[model samples]
Target: MEFDLSWPVLWNGLFWPLIRLTFFISVGLLVGNLIESLQWTRYAAKLADPLARRARLGDISAASFTMAFFSGITANTMLSEAHEKGEISDRELILSNLFNSLPTYFLHLPTIFFIAAPFIGSAAAVYVGLTAFAAIIRTMAIVFSGKFLLPPIKEGCLPCRLDEMEKKRDTKSALQKTWARFKKRLPKVLYLTCPIYTLFFVFKQIGMFAWLQGFMSGSASFFTFLPPEALGIVVFHMAAEFTAGLAAAGAMISDTSLTQTQVILALMLGNVLSSPMRAFRHQFPYYAGIFRPRMAFKLILYNQVTRGLTIALVGTAYALLMT
Candidate 1:
């Protein structure tokens, strides 16, 4: 098939999404990082006290995860920086992130359910209930795992003398330090966010959505038992970005005969499965700067594995509950 390949369509579809993505990601990174840094610096010294640092790390990690649960991009960036700065260890960082991912998925619970409830009519309760149950159970798993199974630090892991001195000589106030760090990181964050935006726009412009829909529709026949939209979402999830998967699910739910539960499941699975790839796109660079490529890869691998297992378990539970 000969494509139009016109400039106007390209700009409208590709350029716009790209621009919007860049703007949102940039704003998220800047504001999120600044707030996190302020909180960290303000409490770091106090928490880092000889009597408090260890306990503080746990609390901070939990708080970070909670923030991330609500919003992934910003919180993940902040927590990764914290990990690099020795505020938290590798295990704690990974566990915190994994724990946060499920909550983040449910952050839109009220909105999603509210929207789906009217559309699905009475069946909405089963859909929402199953999804909520799954999220809660997954969160509990992360919490229990973090509390008992997470590794303990080796003796003298915290820099007692250095921490004390740093706490004593806090020259710049928390707000000042936060602003300084924000300024320093702003350029890099924009540079990264801009390209992602551009790419998103380009993908949209090139009729990628149409192609994805056709391909997924064809494949849906093979997985006839599962909801076509859900299967389609999983397929698009593997090939494209999370937004693509979400868009596909939204379109399918509106047009196709998919249940609300199926749509939510697809969206959740698409999001969870696509995380490793997304992290590679955004987080790998920051991580690589702090550690070698190999080390960064290992860290990402650890994160993906932990996150995947948690998501899978939750998804399974949701599916079972739905049945």
Candidate 2:
């Protein structure tokens, strides 16, 4: 078997994706660090105060809600510690945790958008936007529930002067920090991105996607709502990781076989359907460790259900609008 390694295949498959993604990641890290250094993360904590107050949670949760955007486990740890110490009631604990959903989305939006644009291009914006919308809905729902269920309190539920909050104001200058963040994030980006795109390219070269496309051809009839060519994207999205799904969708998009709405909806469906299992696998055990098992089960279950419904409803509406 003489190897058929050719320049076209190598350039298209490996070099281009790597270079594009690396450039995007570099720019993304720069923007991400700049945004963080500007006190946006701390600002998020201050903004969450009203919601936390409405939820009747301790001021501590305001801090936790802000942290959730940048680091979920850290936020959860703070909330869990408050619960353990009898500072917040069960309802407050759950509601406050739920309220952090929006913050978490905002926390990572810069990174997601910057990297997504280069690979998925503009369509990446739609999917990320939909998810962000869902997070907003989830936060709103939590707010309404908190306002209606919890009684009004007089004391300041807001934490002390947020101005004093550790700004993570590193000693390094902005340029140094941006360079450091870019360096720190590159490995993770490459790890997640390079292998997936390369493998998909190999699969393309070997006709695996073609075979799967044929096998999955009935998508026009089955999915009905989406373009037929989107079958590969849906299959890869559901069967493999999200980047794989995005890779497949991006290919179809470049060829103009699938519309942006179809790509968004397909990825949305994958996200909704995959969310529960993902929550069980990742959140349940983690939550159990933080809270007691029973409480953890309840918290994770609520989070999963709220998230799934939000995504499904928003995605369905978008799909219908597209149709």
Lowest summed lDDT across 10 adjacent residues in model 2 is found at 212-221
Each model's lDDT: 0.58, 0.68
Looking at model 1, report the run of 10 residues with the lowest lDDT sum: 48-57
Task: Name the lDDT value of residue 43 in candidate 2.
Answer: 57
- Give me candidate 1's TM-score against the actual structure: 0.60
Off by over 4 Å in 2: 1-47, 157-223
- State every prediction's TM-score relative to the real structure: 0.60, 0.64
lDDT of 2 by residue, 125-215 (tens): 8888989999999988987788777667557424443555554655467667657755764565456556655665666577664555445
Q: Which number leads on TM-score?
A: 2
Model 1 has a clash total of 3
The sequence of per-residue lDDT tens digits that candidate 1 reaches over residues 1-323 is 44555777766655565566555555656656666644543343334233222323354554555565456666566666677678777767666665555567577777766665654454446555655665565556666665465655444433443354455444357557767776776676556555544554445456674565455435444645566557877777656755565566667667865766787667556656556656665555444433445656776787677656656677677778888
Q: Count the backbone clashes (under 3 Å) in each candidate.
A: 3, 0
